[model samples]
Target: MEFLDEIKAKFPNVLESVDGSNENESVLLLKDKTKIKRVCKEVKNHFDILFMLMAVDKPPKIFELNYVFSSYKTQNILTIRVNIERDKAVIDSISSLFESADWEERETYDLFGVEFIGHKNLKRILLPEDWPGRPLRKDFEVTDEVRNWTGLDLKF
Candidate 1:
């Protein structure tokens, strides 16, 4: 279940390889958006199961996408992460690699407003179509929230 070399050979420098935990663990941090699809494919080939997918919208300039995969053979946990830009926030869907990523990618897209370019069910999973902004992003703000909350400090 050692695919680190495979990853290295296929896509050099795409992964800033994370050292495994003292226990049987594998983790890799991704640095480029374009390389995520290849990494996802490698992970699925090696692991067979994608345990989870999540995204975090860090402020100002970047977002982080995280994936947790489990190898059915070796029973190891592997983490993959990629940092993306705020404006050009798009990545390939992992549905081609792992079928389980369908719902997870939808959830991440709905919540974080990231575009999974090839997802079949890329639609709102948690929010309605009318939802104003990507709530999880640190810069997201409701336009009238302060007025709605404090009611203009009426003196009546």
Candidate 2:
């Protein structure tokens, strides 16, 4: 059985859709955030490496979390996307499954304000703890403090 077919069979309820240009670059949309770790573990057991994890801000209230897994053995790249409401942007932590997810999740949390539930050390990785708001959010505005500190007269 192929990877995509296997995953679809295993997680029919969790998987929302499957898309890709070819077999090598398939993408899966997982509907539930709670099953993220389980899905990631299955992918890892198949020799797929968690290469990237990032968040995308979909304006007007949706945040998309993207996780990219690459299998050197099969030369297959699979991307998983999960969409959550911006007001309640929370998702399970995959740091336990992939160590690299620690920093990646923190960065996503710091910049996008997406909470990685169950993260051992869920704190800011790039910006300071006192940072005003999530910089990567679509509605983020430049604070007067930042403008004063930078000595710039720019408007958001």
Candidate 3:
């Protein structure tokens, strides 16, 4: 299934995206967050299903957001992605447009700590409310319970 042609036929400004196949798939890097929602809807409306959502932690600065969509109509799978900055880690919510995106967005926020600006139920999906730093972050530290493990600290 020529996924790019199908996408262009459905969404005019979705940007030029490449198709990946075989036993593996590469992320379709998007220009920005706005197209993320646009491409997602186009895929669903024209094709008819959602495959999955993924969030990759890009250390020291940002997170990469990915949405995988499949069409029962065309039997093709397409992955769309966007990079969200560390400082402004929020993106417009597609939950308003797609019901399934609700839980996926929450899961991303929960694990990677990226906020969805308009997500009504954007909250920790797999972590407690009071959890300290974002565990998935590359810079996030995993301190030993026994600080004296290295025998360098005398403070109790």
Best by lDDT: 2
Span of 10 residues, lowest total lDDT, candidate 3: 144-153
Tally clashing residue pairs in candidate 1: 0
| Residues 1-156 of candidate 3: C-alpha lDDT, one tens digit per residue | 455666666656645555554323434557757666677666566545555778887777777877776656556666777778887788888787767788998888887778887889878888667666677777777776423244344666
How well is each residue in 7-55 modelled by candidate 2, as lDDT tens digits? 7788889885564446678778988888888888877866456788878
Q: Which lDDT tens digits does candidate 1 get at residues 1-156?
A: 347667767777677676654335666788777878877777677787887897887777888888988878788787888888888888888887788898898888887889999888789887766566677777867678632554245877
Candidates 1 and 2: which is better by TM-score?
A: 2
* Candidate number of the best TM-score: 2
Better of 2 and 3 by TM-score: 2
Q: What's the best-to-worst order under TM-score?
A: 2, 1, 3
Clash count, one per candidate: 0, 0, 0
User: How much lDDT does each candidate structure score?
Assistant: 0.78, 0.83, 0.69
Ranking by lDDT: 2, 1, 3
Local distance difference test, candidate 2:
0.83
lDDT of 2 at 134: 84
TM-score of 3: 0.75
